[model samples]
Target chain A: MRQNSHGPIGVFDSGVGGLTVLKSLMAHLPHESTVYLGDTARVPYGTKSGEVVTRYSLKNAEFLLEQGVKLLVVACNTASAVALPALEAALPIPVVGVIAPGARAALARTRGGGVGVIGTPGTIRSGAYQRALEAADAKVRVKSRACPLFVPLAEEGWTTGDVPLLTAREYLAEFAREGVDTLVLGCTHYPLLKGVIAEVVGPKVALVDSAEATAQAVAALLTERGGLASAGHAAPTHAYYVTDVPERFVEVGARFLGRPIPAAEQVDLTF
Target chain B: MRQNSHGPIGVFDSGVGGLTVLKSLMAHLPHESTVYLGDTARVPYGTKSGEVVTRYSLKNAEFLLEQGVKLLVVACNTASAVALPALEAALPIPVVGVIAPGARAALARTRGGGVGVIGTPGTIRSGAYQRALEAADAKVRVKSRACPLFVPLAEEGWTTGDVPLLTAREYLAEFAREGVDTLVLGCTHYPLLKGVIAEVVGPKVALVDSAEATAQAVAALLTERGGLASAGHAAPTHAYYVTDVPERFVEVGARFLGRPIPAAEQVDLTF
Candidate 1:
């Protein structure tokens, strides 16, 4: 049961939001194959309790591990916030969660100013990003807000115009007032609303995309461990699995992944 | 075992939104004891597939039925839309869903003008309301739109104000332009946004509250079947259950139920 470099990288999200991370991973490490599991049957872990999210995350990770993945990626922010420790302990493979990478990027980007983290209720409530930022630097000031509507807006493709603009302003006005120089896009879906978020927070605040940071971190970890897939393999295959019907995942997932998903195999995590 | 006349009515929703329907049911049927089950672990069935929703609804119904209830109420609009037939066929007790009653009320209220129905994507996509409305009268015109943000907005307590007003205007403008004289507040959570919706749609268009309609429907069905709980039964105990932690449910559920939910016991639906 030794970890092999040829095995696919495992990535999971509560739902399609994690596709952003998968997309980044694909771009960052072209030679690595990937197996993605979208826990569609019980999605939006953002509003659920820590125990419930952890249980669900464990199931998702187990399913991904069965696919012979070398490393596990907790792509969902809510899971990354609440279940990362559990995953790290339970999984034999190395686990990369989006929170730490995003936090590190935010800390590095901030210029002696505070940092703001925006995400779902559960993620913000967990204070994972806040803790990560503060843990990295004792003097780092962190402010957090829960933007529950952003996921729905992004899925509905309402990222632009008045509705999103007003929503972004309402959620980020305090961050702007607090003079935060870097705002971490704590949730994967938030990257889609980058323009509106940037517009609301103004020019000074640097936006850290968790997807990009996590992908880079993953690449670095694999490179250092000598687990990177060799480049001579047939164009790295990407396989998708979901706990529910594949239609919605393929449709909305395209928005997050920035490409077409022809099909996704149906999976049942009940076992 | 036979469904007893004095037994509590069983109600289930994906989450707290159906508390609105429960609120009306409590008001309209004061003598009836009730057991409400919120599927908080996998909440927001709005955007999920029909098969997944029906499966969840069935599990929810089974849990409620085990509570020894006389009647079943599909309080969630998405569940009511897609799972009514299966629920009605599988359960021994009579099942009441919000869609049929709301459609009937809309049919009665509309004065030669078209009817507009607004709800979650799953409910709208199922075309349940449109089918029900048109089935009653072949000549009646119906239009349905999914307002995905409304649920999150309601949960966030952003029921009124410029953002919701603008969102309302954006969603309702088409109905206004198309001259729909009546709009059916198809989703249980939408009753919370009545003020903003009313203002946006104007005075001429009467908005039908499905919760009120559904409550009356349940009352009539129970009365007809001689299943109404007798008045002497310990002030009609109202028990609440959820699949996840009760904190968020109790907090946001108060808004939907129009009062307090002192506590909600957690239950596992994994089997």
Candidate 2:
């Protein structure tokens, strides 16, 4: 791969959720540098309207493009749901989102076309996953629930315990009743509550982490285009930017990244 | 009271949480009109730094002031905790916040000096309530815990149930261990979880709803200052402004206010 292939992969999320996707990218493709932008000043885009989300997503993408990235990743499920098409059309770089990969993964795993997808309100309301899955397989039956509390639960590091388990049960009970054999963790934060989700979802259902699927998609895309970073590339840089407090980003984000985020910095992305 | 004294009371919250306070204000002082601003564009001030929160609060206050409000209410717990002093120092209008009213209510209820406060990270970290309690009575002991997930639970409308009770227990276990006689629901959102919180805190701890106290304070202050709207004010106006997404605000905020929010509009606050 050329030096151009070694350029950083740019990822933007409403907040720390993208760090999970970034971690997966780093683990799977160690040679590729990455730049992440967390719009913490306006975090939880999941609750906002589609128009506001699209606007923020555009600004976030522009900020990352300004940094000279090889690829753009909409690591936020809400942004991916509402703003993916616009982002892809606006940027010259390949734009990857979690929804399609996740939908595909859920389709592959479901015995019954009955797939239950859970995500933030904006993502579920946007119906991106439902549309993506149905487009791939017209016969597929998709049901989605908006689990808005899961983000706060995940960020609070209450991954396990009765709180998360009960929350999971409250959200997943309808899915169980609907006989969904596959459940897509549509929101980036949902993966943190995986154990609780699995237990509540029971043994019959397969829980798909969108982060893992998205990572595989990124790797496949880069490899197919001969855009994979060379192994000879020196220790790849991983930089992080947040629109608000860097301290809280580093603190809450450490749990999401599964590593201390020492490279996180505060940046104003007014674009 | 003069015509100027009858102007609407200005209230500003980061988002819908303040609608809880606004609800109480309306019920307590049915004649008094209100002008509310929910800074939805930059919601979740709890995660942002003191400087950023202070700046937003100032902008929100100025925006409310421009509407010709008689008094200013910092309806957001995060803003009240971190920006109240700055707002009071800068604004000529009487600035009321949840912190002092909540602290007073807690002190009035505590048989012993031990008091437990549960709120967002910003409110807890600001230590405004702790300082307020101690300042009022030097011997009053205050212990605060950041129940960051509570806001999401409240907004998700999952207040009563096994999940909230379990979550409350997890958060307030330390307070129970400390044997706090009084528990203050410091955050505006916390009032929604009063049932679960009371269950977790038990019979010994009195749960003080800050919204109620703040409303009471507002009523008293207005009465003393001769700023109460007249009985014949003829259907006093209740105006609402949001920095972004008026549709979502009215949708999510109805439950918070326990009333349909029909007067909301969007406005840009550049400051």
Candidate 3:
């Protein structure tokens, strides 16, 4: 991981949902410059066909590579499940996707050999989580469910209390029945729904947030590859760019990041 | 209103959430070209200060205007609620926001003169629906609630059945109590949750989908200005572009548009 001087880390997703990953990155690597691109114009990539997803992932990687990102984080579950290989193969930089990190974390946390993974339909359907978990340890049984509403609920800033709790109960009933001791919040957006999910899954099941795990992985990679930004820069400038209105990003993002996002630039991403 | 052959219809939002509006546009006005930009990298304009939302709205409008759009539609509720005046004043083309079309449709359908409005906190806080309803006719009593989770849930693709229904029940209880005759799905994403919302509100209260209303309004605007595409164009060309991964957009978008998205291109939107 030869570091490029002043090159920003490029992180991308279909929408601002990936802010969870970026937030984690910022917290862990305070000195690194970050450039985030959220395809707010066309988001929620968890349901497209494999071929289309691969193409889209390639395009996103291309855009980031164009920006000279020293590292690329596919902070989207759907892309990670379907397009990670293509992205890694196509890009010059190290490509990290959420699924592997999440799976790794789940494997580490599970005590009863029962691990439950919850995310979008595409993620669960791809069997990526199951395969990843099994790859780490063949004995671990992975119970997967698609908690689709959690992403939207998180986006709407519905993190706690009744509605999210109720929705969580509804979405996680199968997982609860499976009685997994460890649960993986497979989507980046799921971390926001932590309280509700934790309540629904009970105190016994350890919840693993993919965002946190992915961030940790990024830190390790940067450190190992000698790409970690050295300490002593002006608070690590975060430049936020989106294909839509910046206002909404700041508004919803504050809840996600737990701070005020100063300014975001609206850019035309039509190429 | 003057139709330009080369300019695309400039549609934007605070984030990818606006794709719901673009989905409607594509369905209703297939022949019309569109340039959609979602500030996905930064999003959730719903909770920002009014001044900030206004500034972001202006920037979004300006970006779209620069793209050479014949018309502009501010699809994000927060932006429409707080920044419509500025956007309209600054832009040369006719600017349409979700509030007016949604409010008008609610007014048209409400038999008891009680309309329920659901949107982001900023949209609800602005009392945009109340004002719009009052402007249409002072007699109409507007009952509004901030359904902050609905947007994220919609984005997560939890449009129907148990989880969304449960969430809707929690959010719409007040509206149901108010005995509203119509419920306005104020956020563009809210329409995706129409089934759950309708179930919660029951058959008596008609559900007004903003995307449909906005589509109708766009149709009316095009018809009135003779900007509607000629009928001879073969099924129209639909191009999708995003600042992030196109994979996630295609996946989440198919559900929004009710079909497979042809393809999405990724573009660098850093400014």
Candidate 4:
């Protein structure tokens, strides 16, 4: 199928967590413009059922597609785990989900001591990363846990200090005992708590940040599809849309996005 | 207007957090049957905008109204703070919200050392309790803080741990410094962490659980409106409904409700 290489890459997550992926994309694919949608009204899809996640994911993808995006990126771990197959089949554009790329990165970095995966309950329960890793190497062992508090801890700006450290230890201490040399941060929000997580699991444990890996995957896919925007093209622009008021999104989203969100328009996803 | 006292009381919340309120209702008003709708698909209204919260609350109320409810209970603190007025105006039946009852309880118990209101960011930002307190007693001083992590901690079953203790201290220490004699647990989920919160605030400061206060308020309103269910009515039936899947709600809700939720019907609020 013919594609317009200049069309912006579209990214959507349950909420502002996807901005982390957008941040990496800006660094990895500088010439490609992007549109990001945060379904803040129904944020935190990590805890919802597969059917509900899929429905919301489809609506989010539809909204992005209407923007004439050349590619679709599911930046949310839970949605990627539960809705990727549905999205891949439904969207006309090439679809990239964080699970496969992050799994690949973990397998490549592990010292053959097994791999640990940490994410929201839905993502872990779906066994997306575990499946992806095992599919590549059947004998590879994977230990996984659902760290539900990490998202709230990250959003609350308690990334450091005793509270987060204790929370991290509570959730991740087992990985060290399990002898997993590599840990995949399956959720976008987990990247914000990387410091505490790293401290808990120790320095020897290689941490796989899905945002960076997903960006690399998108970059490679665009190159292969001849969908990479021309380097000579004008500087890329970023646009944000949200299903709720933009004030809180603008305020809290900066922490996740690594920069202030200049502006975001409110949208109704019912359409 | 003629009313059927046998009609069940309708309660709605953003998610399982409201189950705490329902627990209080079951204890305080044994004869009053209830139908609860938890908007789990769009849970955590605490972080969303007023417009979005109000819209969701209306949909929830409409769903309950269709269930033949004679009274409405806004069981979620964020919704109570942001959507109570809209609910009261839009619904024909009496609408009871947690904020006013909690504020009244705080004022009644304060030993003239002021009152501290703690809740979600949206609830704290709305200043609903502060306005209610001052409106009732203009000379009463009120301090409020947004304890964003409390809800997640409560749901994650970390209510008794070092993490929650530290978090509660972090958010509530200022109340002691401000000489507040009463601390209102303004969020419904807060009742679950009452032990740690009370420890942080100390024995001198009184902690008012909004679940109990709201239950009392609901009971009083029903009595005044002559809408109380008959004492001889069959064992009060409790029905649960959620916008998302029932499994997580049933599991997490049991903790909040203080008993297992036998079943919860999955629903779509779009109608």
Candidate 5:
């Protein structure tokens, strides 16, 4: 009944944005095979209701579980905020979400206890990061804002353009006013706009890349479970599945992953 | 069976964005009732494939037809661009889409032969506006740009901020360089950013709002079909439906509709 060291790690996002998490996973655990599912057919789950996102997250997890994964990563912040608990309770494999790891990292980075969290409206409204950070250290004050424009900016490949920078300044002005010492890149897409975000927040504030934090948590969990991929294993494989093709998912995904994705299998999952 | 003159007109969009079109319809045909469907579960048709958009659009039409509507409006611009033909062919009722009306208005407004069209990536890439303009007048040159950021800016209620003005300038500078005398607001959300867009593009360019144009088209079509609600009919009633509930569709929808949405019925449609 136990998961073996050889099974691939399962990761899923609403769309290619979660490639940020997969990139970090590849960096930290190159020996492990990963299977990623992007629900490109119905993306931007961040804008949907908790029930809808939960239903989708469960279905995505089910598809990966069917593929025999050793662990599961809900790489989307909105799903992590609203659906992580349900996924953890349902899935047999160890489940990791981006929220807790990012919260832990932000809590560790902030010297003055003031921490800022930026994400989608759904994620921010769920109060997942604030709850997680407060649960970690009640003394840490969490100031959260939803920079809804970042998703479209990242998708447009305008991360460094004046528009994104101006948008970041507009979204982050409140956090700067509050003098938060640390900020969590709560959504995967935010990492792509890190330059603008960092500049807007200034060098004094530590920017925590939740995707990187998630990878670290995933690594530690695999090691604890004795499910880490053994060294000398055949070259690790990264497989992608999306609900919609002809979407240039492979093209946009390449930008997010920082490498070419030759192809991704088109998939349809029923919830 | 013939559809009754009293039945509500059906309208569907990828999501709440269609409310803008519905609002225009309310003003243009005050005696006619409306049934609006927002496919919130699978929104942002702006990024999906032509075939997929067509399939979803057909399903949306079928659901509306089942409710006994007199006419159908494809309020989503991406749907109008990619799926309008199929919808027009399949639906028995008179079908109207937002594209042709917007294109016609732009063609009429342009004196310099240079027309600029701005929409979502899917709408722009479909070349629907360009082809529509060229079909009407052979010599009218068309320039199209995908202002992806405008959707988010409008939704975030940042339609007038410095960020939106800067983003508009960034997106519209090319149109200025090309000396476009007429610009079509090819997507429903773009109309909300009219102030910023107008300032960026200057006074010489005429802005055509697709929602308003579509409303006019629907009015003319209903009259041609003799399906217009009889004069002296009671004040119009508008009903709303969405695939995802608690999505703040009602709240965000108010901005798009320019009036509060009292409620929306959550629905699940089978394609």
Candidate 6:
């Protein structure tokens, strides 16, 4: 296996929602050390504007960069939609965002060139997914909706229920009408709502999780760039850092990552 | 008014929640130009440890102070519980926290010296409210419970409904069992759940909103310091800055403030 001299891969989102993407990364790149940061102090980037999301994304990326990460992943839909271009341009390390990967995956799965996307208002408004799909194939018909409440609902652990299912139906009604064959869970947080969303969109529509796809993209990039962790490296270590309370991050993040999170350290990054 | 040539008022929270306190400040002190920063990009300070919350709180305050805020409001309950002392000592400006004011108000309202407090797990565990109430009057029996889901639920606008009411009941049952005559909405976000909480705890239990009480404290401080907005001044201007998207802030904020938020700007305050 090729070896990259640089340290851990840095992944961050507005909050714990990004754990979904981090989880996928852990699964795909089991030997790679990962540094995960959830701006648990200020989360839910989905509803923010492009400029603000960009700024926050930069800050988060900078924080991760400071931790000596070899690669950066903006594991957030809103950030990916609005900040990806600037982040990719500005960051020293290679940056991969969730949007394009998810879009690519959706394009591959869609049989009729019809795809659906759901994320925060900011992500949906940015039209990143539509543009990505179109860039891949102009013939593709893309439908997008902003499921703002889904982040909060999922964070609250309302993943499977009448209320979440009903909310999912209300938000995904447009895609259902447009008859998309594949749907992208545009926001990393949206993956938690996968069950309800899958139920609402029906079994015929393939669900694309950007987290999973982004992880694959990261793995591919690492393999190509000689950044893959050396074989026999004890199961890749995961360290969690948050701007807010670590206990809550552990509790909530455990649910998202499907396992216990090690104690998180709090850092004051105002310098 | 004998006002010092200080910069704008500095307000910081773990996340967008400080916006609620900022809204109240704008309403009460319109002429006072303000700079508001929601660590929206890294929120939910409620679940972190005291050391971490304090560290983040100091960083947040330092950021606002660097922007030249004359006074600082630790608008987050978890931060207030853990970081108030450190903030007051470290910052030059007078630092105010939500817990003391809200606890005082609840103590004032409780007829039987029985007070209930609800906040995030960190806040409840810190015993900030309990200490504040007891400090006001040792005879006051303080009952505290952590309502971890309330913040996410409130952020999602699930304030008043059968589901919210049921959740409130489940969380508030312990407090009700303690026979408290007054309840403190410890977290800034908890105010949004007032209706549901009121319904569960009954109208007889006075619901003390920390935001309102904190606003009153600001008013009193300004009056004493002769920094009150000119009496004849028109509505105080409000400017919002978040580390995340401004659109979501305005949308979720509108529900909290019960009015459409005026234009909010996105800012990069990585430091």
Recovered fraction of real interface contacts per model? 0.79, 0.72, 0.30, 0.84, 0.84, 0.47
Which model scores highest in lDDT? 1
In candidate 2, list every pair of residues with a backbone clash: none
Q: Which ten residues in a row have the lowest lDDT in candidate 2 chain A?
A: A1-10
Cα lDDT tens digits for candidate 2, B1-271: 3336678999999999899999999999898889999998878888677878898899888888899998998888889999988998998889999889989988999998499888888888888988999999999888989888888788778888788888888899999888999998888888788888888878878888788889999989888877788898578889989988798789889988998988689887733
TM-score of chain A, model number 4: 0.97
Residue-level lDDT tens digits of model 2 in A1-271? 3325867999999999988999898888888999999998778899888878888898888889889998998999999999998898898889999899988988889997499999998999999999999999999988889998888888778888888888888888998887889999988898888899989878899998778788999999998888988887688888999988688889889988999988678877642
- Give Cα distance to truth, residue A50, candidate 5, Å: 1.0
lDDT for each residue of candidate 4 in A51-73, tens digit (9 for 90 to 100): 99999999999999999999999
Q: Give per-residue CA lDDT, model 6, range A1-271, as digits (tens).
A: 4435448999988878788898899889878888998876555567555776687678788888888899998888888888988998888888899888898899889899488888887899999999998999889988778776787677667788676777777678777777889988887787778898888888889998888889999999998988877868666678899876577788888888888986998765544
Report interface Cα RMSD per prediction: 1.3, 2.3, 7.4, 1.5, 2.3, 3.9
In the range A126-180, model 1's lDDT, one tens digit per residue, is 9999888888998998889999889888877998999999999899899988899
Q: After superposition, how far is residue A214 of candidate 4 from its true place, in Å?
A: 1.5
Query: Please, what is the whole-model Cα lDDT of each candidate in the order they appear?
Result: 0.91, 0.87, 0.78, 0.90, 0.88, 0.79
- Steric clash count of candidate 1: 0
For residues B1-271, could you state the per-residue lDDT of candidate 5 as single tens digits? 3457998999999887888899999999989989999998888888788877888898889999988899999999999999988987897888888999998988778896599999998899999999999899988888999988888788778888788898898899998877899999998888889999999888999999888788999988777777889878777788899988834888888878888888899987632
State candidate 3's DockQ. 0.19
Tens-place lDDT digits, model 6, residues B1-271:
4545335677777666767787787777767777777766556677656776676677678777777777888888888898888988897777889988888888779898488888998899999888888888988877788887788777767777665776787688777666788888888888778888988888778888777788889878877887655644554455567766566777777765567878666665555
Model 3 lDDT per residue over A1-271, tens place? 4777467889988777788898899888889988888766445666445655576667677777787789999899988998888887888788899999999988888886599988887788899989998888988988888876677667666688777787788778777777899998887788778887888888889999888889999999988888877777455677777765677777777776667888877655533
Tens digit of per-residue lDDT, candidate 4, span B193-237: 989998988889988877888899887777777778887768889
**Candidate 4 chain B weakest lDDT stretch, 10 residues:** B219-228
Q: What TM-score against the true fold does each predicted structure earn?
A: 0.97, 0.92, 0.65, 0.97, 0.95, 0.79
Look at candidate 4 and give me any clashing residue pairs.
Answer: none
Q: Model 6: what is its DockQ?
A: 0.33
